[model samples]
Target: MSNPYFQFKQFTVWHDQCAMKVGTDGVLLGAWASVERARRILDIGTGTGLVALMLAQRSLPDAKIVALEIDEAAAGQARENVARSPWQERIEVVQADFKKYRSSDKFDVIVSNPPYFVDSLECPDRQRAAARHNDSLTYEELLEGVNRLLAADGLFTVVIPTDVVDRVKAIASMNKLYAIRQLNVITKPGGIPKRTLIAFSFSNRECVIEELLTELARHQYSEEYIALTREYYLNM
Candidate 1:
């Protein structure tokens, strides 16, 4: 099969120029985001337009989805991917950094699989490095931007490494965004938790946390994982 395309049950993602391909992180964020009744949605750092397309597929038919990508090549590929989707008319990909892109209207839902590897080693390619590093879009910048662009009741969802959850929570608190729901994901029964999928809102009520396991063993998927993503994953 084609290395550049990842075919889902409802949609297919074509990711040739993006530094990151269709991965578990993107899928987790897409499947985990709260799309119920959301009329407008934004996908920050939309590499390959995967999350945006997933949101489009999950949301109402009239929903408007916007995807923002910083890398030129990735943005071009994302545009192509979005245009070929059935929700093409409802989705638009913008070639602009999330920090520099200005939007007057606030979205009902905002999602991101942001680059949270702070102080990490840099890669050789400048674009890839920028996409992977926190230098181009810091956590502070992301939270501030979300604060500015998200509606009062809008939900912001993201996926990050488990180690970064505290830092992200602190940043979100500074911006007055509270973690309303969280899902901790592990690879297997006894493995270390690698990722955290979080949902934030402007409310300050007590937070709800949930633990989740993605796989039962190496290369073996769990029933919960399959159930959550069965609509998208073709094999499921």
Candidate 2:
């Protein structure tokens, strides 16, 4: 069986009960999203609460983080993971549908490693399918919630398949959100980028684009990836 938990430098995430397990996408979003000086953060579709915990670790001592999960089991596991972490006091795990979620307080930063598989054949497991497919939470719904809950100056960050980057950008544009920063993630040297990380804001800013290579060769991690994730990944 796959390991039920991922052991990070600062926390342990047990995901046996969650449909989604720990993965690099969540780590990338957690570590790469801009969190400097963020006093309040929201993590949408926090399947295992991985990103939320990472943000808590990166944020200031007084920062408050909310990890929203649509699945009850996943939320429970997230709560357990947060409870065991050193930053438990800084994180709250909420089980709610993001489309209907309401928060009186605006967030300084919002992040999600959202489902990206579009119209693909789904696996038999219903929970895993929900976690992996976009049917449960479309980019439209996700951005709508971001628009509603984000502070005027807050940034919304997401990691999605590079193929759909333009589509998402168009959706964000419709919502009056502009892409301010982007990071293309390549699997290896000279390999095509498969995933793109983007940070959007209500106010237009000059878009900054960068690239990250996960490896120089198979099983050999690149320096850029190591440096970006050194704080959370034990081996790095």
Candidate 3:
């Protein structure tokens, strides 16, 4: 079993009450996401407020960050976690289904490590099943929500299974969100990509495609990964 919480350099993410525990995917999205131009930020499906906290730690002190979650219990945990962090005043946790979530204000940057599995066996735990599967929040639904909340020049970013990269890119296109940057994540130098980190914007801008290797070998983290996450991970 995983631990009840994950300790980082600046904060702790308590996950005992959340369906999805802290993982590398969340860490990657949190560290890799660009908040340079973000004044207002939003995190969708923020299980334990990890990404929300990470962004706030790296962003300007005045940046407004919101963590949106559909699960009531998870949302409560997120709120508690954020309150314990240094960025409590900067990050807000909201319990609302992204599909029905409405905000009169638009966000400058939106990041998510959303449910990506479209075809997968359900976990015995219903809450985890909900957190892991895409049924509750389909790609189309996520894209629509992003399109609705994202400002014209704002960026919408996500990390998803590589198997569905093409399909997701197409859906983003349909939603009028163009792919602006992409990073294929692999386990090793020559390994096949397992996940794709993508960033989208409203304009038809030139897309920058790149590759990221997370590990040099089994149990050995790569330099690039260390550098990217050095500010957050305790041992990095």
Candidate 4:
């Protein structure tokens, strides 16, 4: 694959060396993560620095964004992408596993498009498999890390397969993190939901569920989807 497999309006991501390339899930989480008033943000498993760059573009100018990736190759590619962005100074890519990384400061918002293919069939490539599977970072570890790193009023957002939403919610609840908002992402009008975008917080509030259809049919993007993603998507 070429260096830049994906290009946005203001930035281009080089994912040739990354096991995970730029994808819609990362774009959704990047644009969907609430960063309007957030001054400090953290992105876990930032594959190609897509989410961090999106947050940098969406958030305030002075917002400080940190991204963590375990794979050295992916982290290097992320660093390159961050350096090319306009908000380079405000964003930093750390080559470390989220479970072992520590910080004195708590983040106002934490977002992730984590590895959730637990107990599923494994792929041939070890790095790609690790990035997609739970062998390197488990749900428990991710939840615990979020609990430790998130501020009291902070919110944690993630994009996961709909099948795992219940299990993820259970794990998050065990750590006292509650879902405040959720969006079910479907490909078409009657198609089964493929992903769930969940926003959680420390406070226990009534969950607001919103069903979002990305497209009315194949190759047709919905108005709502375009509206939500217009800022970062070049063709939207």
Clash numbers, per candidate: 0, 0, 0, 0
lDDT of 2 by residue, 1-236 (tens): 99989999989999999988999899999999999889999999999999999999878999999999999999999999999999989999999999889989999999999987887999799999999999989999998889888999999999999999999999999999999999999997888999999999999879999999999888799999999999999999
Tens-place lDDT digits, model 1, residues 21-73: 89999999998899999999999999899999989988998999999988899
> Which wins on lDDT, candidate 3 or candidate 4?
3
List of clashing residue pairs for candidate 1: none
Tens digit per residue, CA lDDT, model 3, 63-89: 999899989899999999998999888
The Cα local distance difference test for each model comes to 0.91, 0.93, 0.93, 0.91
Tell me the spans in candidate 4 whose CA falls farther than 4 Å from its real position.
1-3
lDDT of 4 by residue, 1-236 (tens): 35556888998888988998888899889878788689999999998999999999879889999989999999988999888889889999999988899999999999999997888999999999989998889889999999999999999999999999999999999999999999999888888888999999999999999988898887799999999999888899
Q: Give Cα distance to truth, residue 33, candidate 3, Å.
A: 0.9
> How do all models score by TM-score?
0.97, 0.98, 0.97, 0.97
Best by TM-score: 2
| Model 1 lowest lDDT segment of ten | 114-123
Error of 1 at 36 (Å): 0.9
| Model 2, global lDDT | 0.93
The 10 consecutive residues of candidate 2 with the worst lDDT sum are 114-123
Residue 66 CA displacement from its true place in model 2, Å: 0.5
How close to the true structure is residue 32 of candidate 3, measured as C-alpha lDDT? 89
